[model samples]
Target: MASMLKDLWNRFAGGGNASVHEEPAAEAVEYKGFRIRPAPYSAKGGFQTAGVIEKDFESGMKEYRFVRAETHPSKDEAATFSVTKGKQIIDEQGDRVFR
Candidate 1:
């Protein structure tokens, strides 16, 4: 009964179920040696990436690199680019780049 009224109200409001279809959010993709994780959709109707970098100077000392897809137009592209860059950095810096 409640659903019927809701459906009737939707039809009257011009927001009938016929015109309502929710699109599934984009899933993260992994490419090359990088992992691309999808984030929640933004108000602008697209997802935005979040980048984080961590470094520890205590004990064994460690540095972590976390680059998100914010700079790239797509998540897969970002992951590939980031991984390539990371590989270059590691190759150049060696063990100093991490713990």
Candidate 2:
């Protein structure tokens, strides 16, 4: 299957431990009844804008992760942009983003 091939490729390319570690996540920011955690990862000679937005629903906790094309020279700048983007997404889409 395609998944099997992808797994094989990952093992060969990533030494089979790609999922074991990750860049430490930034502290969560509470905003508009949601939690946004910036997680900038180094990429393409810079830090890439990334983050996770979460909310507690009656059903359960829901989360959405975003990675923008924007990159910054420093992790702090990337994280700042990530939070801003997360806020924009929440303001524009709200809970419908989890849909």
> Highest TM-score among the candidates is held by which one?
2
TM-score of each: 0.35, 0.76
TM accuracy, model 1:
0.35
lDDT of 1 by residue, 1-99 (tens): 898567535533437432112121234333333333322222123333332122334464353333232445564454445445555554566556554
Each prediction's whole-model lDDT (CA): 0.39, 0.77
List of clashing residue pairs for candidate 2: none
Steric overlap count per candidate: 0, 0
Model 2, span 4-49: residue lDDT tens = 5675355334345431124535788999999998877666588767
In candidate 1 the C-alpha lDDT for residue 66 amounts to 37
In model 1, what lDDT does residue 44 have?
Answer: 25
Give the residue spans of candidate 2 off by over 4 A.
1-24
